[model samples]
Target: MTRKLTSQDAEALAVSALVYVANDPVLLPRFLALTGIEAPAIRQAAREPGFLAGVLRFILAHEPTLTAFAEHAGVAPAAVGEALKALPTGDDRYLAST
Candidate 1:
Protein backbone atom coordinates (compact mmCIF):
# COMPACT_ATOMS: atom_id res chain seq x y z
CA MET A 1 0.00 0.00 0.00
CA THR A 2 1.14 3.53 -0.67
CA ARG A 3 1.30 5.60 2.46
CA LYS A 4 -0.21 9.03 2.15
CA LEU A 5 1.80 12.08 3.05
CA THR A 6 0.52 14.02 6.00
CA SER A 7 1.14 17.71 6.56
CA GLN A 8 3.72 16.73 9.13
CA ASP A 9 5.40 14.42 6.71
CA ALA A 10 5.55 17.13 4.10
CA GLU A 11 7.03 19.47 6.64
CA ALA A 12 9.70 16.96 7.66
CA LEU A 13 10.66 16.30 4.09
CA ALA A 14 10.86 20.00 3.36
CA VAL A 15 13.05 20.59 6.37
CA SER A 16 15.29 17.68 5.55
CA ALA A 17 15.74 18.95 2.04
CA LEU A 18 16.46 22.43 3.23
CA VAL A 19 18.94 21.19 5.80
CA TYR A 20 20.66 19.12 3.20
CA VAL A 21 20.89 22.01 0.81
CA ALA A 22 21.79 24.58 3.40
CA ASN A 23 24.75 22.50 4.44
CA ASP A 24 26.19 23.06 1.04
CA PRO A 25 28.28 26.23 1.10
CA VAL A 26 27.25 27.11 -2.43
CA LEU A 27 23.59 27.00 -1.55
CA LEU A 28 23.85 28.15 2.04
CA PRO A 29 23.53 31.86 1.31
CA ARG A 30 20.46 31.48 -0.79
CA PHE A 31 18.90 29.08 1.66
CA LEU A 32 19.51 31.42 4.55
CA ALA A 33 18.00 34.30 2.63
CA LEU A 34 15.00 32.25 1.71
CA THR A 35 14.51 30.96 5.25
CA GLY A 36 15.46 34.21 6.98
CA ILE A 37 17.88 32.38 9.22
CA GLU A 38 20.93 34.31 10.36
CA ALA A 39 23.88 33.50 8.16
CA PRO A 40 26.50 33.02 10.84
CA ALA A 41 24.29 30.87 12.97
CA ILE A 42 23.22 28.82 10.00
CA ARG A 43 26.81 28.37 8.92
CA GLN A 44 27.73 27.15 12.39
CA ALA A 45 24.71 24.89 12.57
CA ALA A 46 25.42 23.47 9.11
CA ARG A 47 28.58 21.93 10.47
CA GLU A 48 26.57 19.79 12.89
CA PRO A 49 23.90 17.47 11.61
CA GLY A 50 22.27 17.38 15.01
CA PHE A 51 21.93 21.14 15.00
CA LEU A 52 20.22 21.08 11.64
CA ALA A 53 17.84 18.41 12.91
CA GLY A 54 17.17 20.43 16.04
CA VAL A 55 16.46 23.54 14.01
CA LEU A 56 13.97 21.63 11.92
CA ARG A 57 12.31 20.29 15.05
CA PHE A 58 12.09 23.72 16.58
CA ILE A 59 10.53 25.06 13.41
CA LEU A 60 7.89 22.33 13.51
CA ALA A 61 7.01 22.78 17.15
CA HIS A 62 6.63 26.50 16.63
CA GLU A 63 4.51 26.29 13.52
CA PRO A 64 1.30 27.43 15.14
CA THR A 65 2.84 30.68 16.25
CA LEU A 66 5.00 31.26 13.22
CA THR A 67 2.66 33.02 10.86
CA ALA A 68 3.31 36.51 12.11
CA PHE A 69 6.90 35.77 12.86
CA ALA A 70 7.41 34.41 9.40
CA GLU A 71 5.77 37.41 7.85
CA HIS A 72 7.95 39.72 9.84
CA ALA A 73 10.98 37.77 8.83
CA GLY A 74 9.99 38.16 5.19
CA VAL A 75 9.76 34.43 4.66
CA ALA A 76 6.85 32.76 2.93
CA PRO A 77 4.37 31.65 5.58
CA ALA A 78 3.45 28.50 3.74
CA ALA A 79 7.03 27.54 3.14
CA VAL A 80 8.06 28.14 6.71
CA GLY A 81 5.02 26.38 8.08
CA GLU A 82 5.46 23.44 5.77
CA ALA A 83 9.11 23.16 6.65
CA LEU A 84 8.16 23.16 10.31
CA LYS A 85 5.78 20.27 9.84
CA ALA A 86 8.52 18.31 8.08
CA LEU A 87 10.42 17.78 11.29
CA PRO A 88 11.06 14.21 12.34
CA THR A 89 8.68 12.82 14.91
CA GLY A 90 9.83 10.80 17.94
CA ASP A 91 12.98 12.86 18.15
CA ASP A 92 12.67 14.95 21.26
CA ARG A 93 16.26 15.99 21.25
CA TYR A 94 16.00 17.66 17.85
CA LEU A 95 12.94 19.62 18.87
CA ALA A 96 14.17 20.51 22.34
CA SER A 97 16.48 23.39 21.52
CA THR A 98 15.25 24.56 18.14
Candidate 2:
Protein backbone atom coordinates (compact mmCIF):
# COMPACT_ATOMS: atom_id res chain seq x y z
CA MET A 1 0.00 0.00 0.00
CA THR A 2 1.11 3.50 -0.69
CA ARG A 3 1.87 5.62 2.33
CA LYS A 4 0.28 9.00 2.74
CA LEU A 5 2.67 11.90 2.28
CA THR A 6 3.59 14.17 5.15
CA SER A 7 5.21 17.58 5.46
CA GLN A 8 8.50 15.88 6.29
CA ASP A 9 8.27 13.88 3.09
CA ALA A 10 7.67 17.05 1.11
CA GLU A 11 10.72 18.66 2.70
CA ALA A 12 12.79 15.62 1.81
CA LEU A 13 11.58 15.75 -1.78
CA ALA A 14 12.47 19.43 -2.00
CA VAL A 15 15.91 18.75 -0.53
CA SER A 16 16.38 16.04 -3.13
CA ALA A 17 15.43 18.45 -5.86
CA LEU A 18 17.92 21.00 -4.50
CA VAL A 19 20.65 18.37 -4.46
CA TYR A 20 19.73 17.30 -7.96
CA VAL A 21 20.14 20.86 -9.18
CA ALA A 22 23.36 21.41 -7.29
CA ASN A 23 25.00 18.35 -8.82
CA ASP A 24 24.01 19.18 -12.39
CA PRO A 25 26.63 21.05 -14.39
CA VAL A 26 24.06 22.75 -16.60
CA LEU A 27 21.25 23.31 -14.16
CA LEU A 28 23.44 24.50 -11.32
CA PRO A 29 24.44 27.69 -13.09
CA ARG A 30 20.88 28.45 -14.05
CA PHE A 31 19.62 27.76 -10.56
CA LEU A 32 22.23 30.03 -9.05
CA ALA A 33 21.60 32.74 -11.60
CA LEU A 34 17.87 32.67 -11.10
CA THR A 35 17.95 32.40 -7.33
CA GLY A 36 20.92 34.72 -6.87
CA ILE A 37 22.10 32.23 -4.29
CA GLU A 38 25.78 31.60 -4.30
CA ALA A 39 27.04 28.03 -4.06
CA PRO A 40 28.76 28.82 -0.76
CA ALA A 41 25.52 30.16 0.73
CA ILE A 42 23.20 27.39 -0.42
CA ARG A 43 23.26 25.51 2.85
CA GLN A 44 22.46 28.72 4.68
CA ALA A 45 19.73 29.64 2.22
CA ALA A 46 18.10 26.24 2.58
CA ARG A 47 17.17 27.19 6.12
CA GLU A 48 15.23 30.22 5.00
CA PRO A 49 11.47 30.07 4.75
CA GLY A 50 10.04 29.50 1.30
CA PHE A 51 13.43 28.44 -0.08
CA LEU A 52 12.45 24.82 -0.55
CA ALA A 53 9.22 25.86 -2.17
CA GLY A 54 11.23 27.98 -4.57
CA VAL A 55 13.41 24.98 -5.39
CA LEU A 56 10.35 22.94 -6.20
CA ARG A 57 8.99 25.81 -8.24
CA PHE A 58 12.22 25.97 -10.16
CA ILE A 59 12.01 22.29 -10.96
CA LEU A 60 8.34 22.48 -11.90
CA ALA A 61 8.94 25.41 -14.21
CA HIS A 62 10.48 23.21 -16.90
CA GLU A 63 8.95 20.02 -18.21
CA PRO A 64 12.26 18.35 -18.99
CA THR A 65 13.73 19.29 -15.66
CA LEU A 66 10.63 18.09 -13.87
CA THR A 67 10.75 14.81 -15.76
CA ALA A 68 14.44 14.37 -15.08
CA PHE A 69 14.04 15.07 -11.38
CA ALA A 70 11.04 12.80 -11.08
CA GLU A 71 12.92 10.01 -12.79
CA HIS A 72 16.00 10.57 -10.67
CA ALA A 73 13.99 10.65 -7.46
CA GLY A 74 11.87 7.63 -8.43
CA VAL A 75 8.65 9.52 -7.98
CA ALA A 76 5.80 10.44 -10.24
CA PRO A 77 6.01 13.97 -11.59
CA ALA A 78 2.70 14.62 -9.91
CA ALA A 79 4.37 14.01 -6.57
CA VAL A 80 6.22 17.27 -7.04
CA GLY A 81 2.92 19.08 -7.20
CA GLU A 82 1.81 17.29 -4.08
CA ALA A 83 5.03 18.20 -2.33
CA LEU A 84 4.57 21.82 -3.39
CA LYS A 85 1.14 21.83 -1.86
CA ALA A 86 2.48 20.25 1.31
CA LEU A 87 4.90 23.15 1.74
CA PRO A 88 3.64 26.05 3.84
CA THR A 89 4.74 28.61 1.28
CA GLY A 90 3.41 26.85 -1.78
CA ASP A 91 1.82 29.19 -4.31
CA ASP A 92 -1.36 27.19 -4.05
CA ARG A 93 -1.51 27.84 -0.34
CA TYR A 94 -0.97 31.58 -0.82
CA LEU A 95 -3.64 31.65 -3.50
CA ALA A 96 -6.01 29.66 -1.37
CA SER A 97 -5.53 31.95 1.59
CA THR A 98 -5.91 35.16 -0.28
Provide the RMSD of all predictions against the true structure, rounded to 1 decimal. 9.2, 2.4
The stretch of ten residues in a row with the least summed lDDT in candidate 2 is 89-98
* Candidate 1 lDDT trough over 10 residues, lowest sum: 85-94
Error of 1 at 35 (Å): 5.1
Local lDDT at 20 for model 1: 48
Q: Candidate 2 lDDT, tens digit per residue, 13-85?
A: 9999999999999999999999999999999999988899999999999999999999999999999988998
Model 1 per-residue lDDT tens digits across residues 37-80: 78767656556545444454444444543453455445555655
lDDT of 2 at 13: 100
Please tell me which predicted candidate would have the highest lDDT against the true structure: 2
Tell me how far the alpha carbon of residue 34 in candidate 1 is from the true structure, in angstroms, after superposition. Answer: 4.5
Error of 1 at 7 (Å): 1.2
What is the TM-score of candidate 1?
Answer: 0.34
Clash count of each predicted structure: 4, 0
